[model samples]
Target: MKTLLLLLFLLLLPIKTYSAVIEKIEIIGLKWTKEKFVRRELLFKEGDNFSKEKLKNSIRNLLNTHLFYKITPEVKEKDGKVTVVLKTKERFPIVPIPKFRAKTNRAFKTGIEIRDYNFRGMGNHIFLGLTKWFKNEHSERNFYINSMFYRIIKDRIDVGITLNFFNSYNNVFTKDNKVLGNYDLKSFKANVYMIEYLDLEKIRRLMLSFRPEINKYSNWIESTNQYYLSLGFTVDKTTDMVYYTEGSFYSFYIDFAEPNLSTVFTGSLIGTYSNSLKRGNINTLSFGGSVGTKIGYSGNGFLLDSGIPGYVSDKVKGKRFFNFKIFYRLALINKTVFIKPTIAGGDAFSNIPDNFLISPGFEVEAFWARLVDGIIRFKIFKGIGSGSDVQTSLKLGFRW
Candidate 1:
C-alpha cells in the first residue's frame, strides 16, 4: 500500500507544479493607471513562474514609480492555475507646493510649483512654476514650465522639454562688505532632449540635447543668443526609502555650442555613492563630488559661483561641489518619522548633488514625512568662509 501511494504521489506532482504557474494577473485600484505601465515594471506575467520572490520584486518595481502610496499583492491558486492580484492605493499625483529660501539679511525667493508626477498615469513628470525674487529694494520674477522626464517608449526612450524666462536682481558686494550694487540679470532659454535607455533596468542611458539660450545684462547693454548641442551618458542604480538610500551613480557629458563651436566646448563628470545599515541604531551615509570646466565662454554668468557670500549668484566659469552626509533615525512613526540632526557638509543640497553653486557650508537638517510620502525639511546652515551668513531654508520635497 505504501508503494502504491508513492506511485500515485509522483504522478500527481507534475500536475500540481503546473497549477502553481501563473495563468493570469489582475490589477486592482489602479483606476488612473494604465495597465501596460504597471505590467512593464512587473517581473512575471501569464504562463510564467509565480514565485513569492518574483511577486515581491514586481511590487518593488511598482513602488519605484511613486504612483501609489501602497501596493498589496495577492496570489490566488485555483484547481489548476495561479492568479496574481495587485491592490494599490494611488497617491494624489497632482501637488501644488509653495517654496521659500533665504539667507540671513540676504534676498529670498517665494513661489508656487504645481507638479504632476504621474501625468495621465504614464509615469511622466510635468511642472510649471512662477517665483518672485525679493531683494532689499530690487526684485524680479521668473517663470518656468518643464517636462523634464517623460517616458516615450516603454523601457527604451525618454524625452525632456523645458522653457525658462528668468529675471534676477543679483546683489553685488564690495571688498569692504558693503553693497556695491546689484546686477540685473535677464535670460530666456528653451531645451529639448532625448534619452535612449540602453538596458532593461533603465539605469543606463545615452542622451542628446539641444538648447537655445539668450543671456543679457539688464543694466549693461550686452546680450547674446547661443545654441548648444550635447551628448551624455549616465548610470544610476539607486534605491531611496523614507529613512535610507543605497546606490551608486555616475555620469559623463560633453557639450558644443554654435556661437564658438571650435572654442566653445565643455565637459563634465558627476557621481555619487550611498549605503545604509538598516539593522542597527545607525542608518545612512552618503558622499559625492563633482568637477567640470568650460573650454571657452569666460564671460559673466558663465560660472554661477563667486566664492563670496551674498554676492551675485552667477559669476563663475564652471562648477565644483562636494558633500558628506549622515542620517540617524530620531523616531519611528510609520517607517521612520524624522531624521534628527541630519548633518551634511559641502554642497548642502540633499539627494542629488545637481546644485553646483557651492556655498561650502555645514547643514543641520530635520525632516518629517506624511502618509502619502511627503517630506518637509527645515535646514539651518552656516557658511564656512568669512562674511558668511546664518542661512535658513524651508524646502518641501515632493516625492513624486
Candidate 2:
C-alpha cells in the first residue's frame, strides 16, 4: 500500500523537527567579581538563542548574588552553535557580633552581651549595652543602658538609631495595673530605610520612624510623657520552594503613627505568609495579620496615666478606635535552628459620633531568635493574655 504509507511519514518527521529546535536560548548576563563584572554590566553576549528553559534561568541568576559561593552553568552544542558558560565561587563577608540574655524580678537582669560589628563596607553598625535591674526585695541592684545605630547606602540609604532603658519591664503597656513595681521605660528611636531590588530574589522596603517616649511609674502612678511619629512600607517576595527548603517568603507592611498623647492617630496593617515543607527535617507554616485605626485630631489626653481601669478620660473629643488581628506560626528547626509559636487575637472598638465600644484580647508567644555563629542571639519573649486585661510577660534580648 504505497510503501506502507511512506513509512508513517518518515516517523513523524523527527518528532516535529525536535520540537521546533527550541527557539531561543537563554542566560543573558550574570555577574559578581572582576569588580562586580565591570560595575554590574554582568558579561554574557552573542546573538543568544539556546533553550533548556534558558539554561535553567541562567542558573537561578548566578545564585541570587549574595556574593556567590559556587554556581555553575555550562552548555555547549557544536555544528548548530550554542554555548553558555558561567562558573563562579567566591565568598567572604562578615559583620556579626551582638549577643544577649536576660531575666527580671520586676525590672533589669541580664548576662553575657558584647556588641561591636566592625564596619566599613559602606555600611556601618554599632551597639553598646549593659544592664542589671532589681531594686528592692533583697536583689538590690540597678544600672541600665543600651544603644544601636546602623547606616548603609550600598543598595540605597538606610539609617537608624535605637536607645532603650530598663527595657520596659517586658512591656505590657509599660506596667501599671499592679505589676510588682519598679518601672522605667525610656525610648528614643529614629529610622529611615529604603531598599529596592525587584528581580533576582525580589525586595522592596521603606520606613520612616521617630519615637520619643518616657514613662516612669514607680511608687504607683503619674510619670508619663509620649511622642511618636511613624510611617512604614514593606513588600518582599521570594521563590524556589520545593525540597532543599530555603525559600518561600512573603511579607507586607503599612503603618502611620502620630501620638503626642493619644487622641488617636495610628493606622497600621501588617501581614506575613511563609511556606515550607519537607520530611526528613524541614517544616514551616506562618500566617499573620493586623489592622488598627484610631483617628482623632485634637483633644490630646490619656497617654498612659496608669491606664486600664475604667479607661475614658473624656478629652478624647472626636473619638474613634478599631483594631483587628490574627496569627499562626509554627516552625521547628526549619533549616538551621528555629522554634516559633504564636497565636494572637485582638479587638478594640470605640466611637463617639454614634457611640460604640468593644474590647477583646488574646495573645500567646514562645520565641527564639538566633545566629550565634555570627556572634549573638538566643532571644526570648513570652506573653500571655486571655481577655479583659490580664497580661503577662517574660523577655530576653539580643539582636545584631
lDDT of 1 at 207: 90
Give the least accurate 10-residue stretch of model 1, judged by summed lDDT: 308-317
Q: TM-score each candidate.
A: 0.72, 0.25
lDDT of 1 by residue, 1-400 (tens): 9999999999878664433789889988876678989988887889986688778667766766667667888878987679998987776777787877774889887898888777878878788999986774557788999895556755668888999998766646354777655567788999999999786556788999999999886554457778878888888676544345456667777776666333555433344444444545435445444444444454423332223222133322235445455555444454544444444444322234544333433333333322333576555545444334556555665444
lDDT of 2 by residue, 103-203 (tens): 46444454444443323322234445554534433332223333322223453444666655543443333335655535444433433334444333234
- TM for candidate 1 is 0.72
lDDT winner among the candidates?
Answer: 1
lDDT of each: 0.64, 0.39
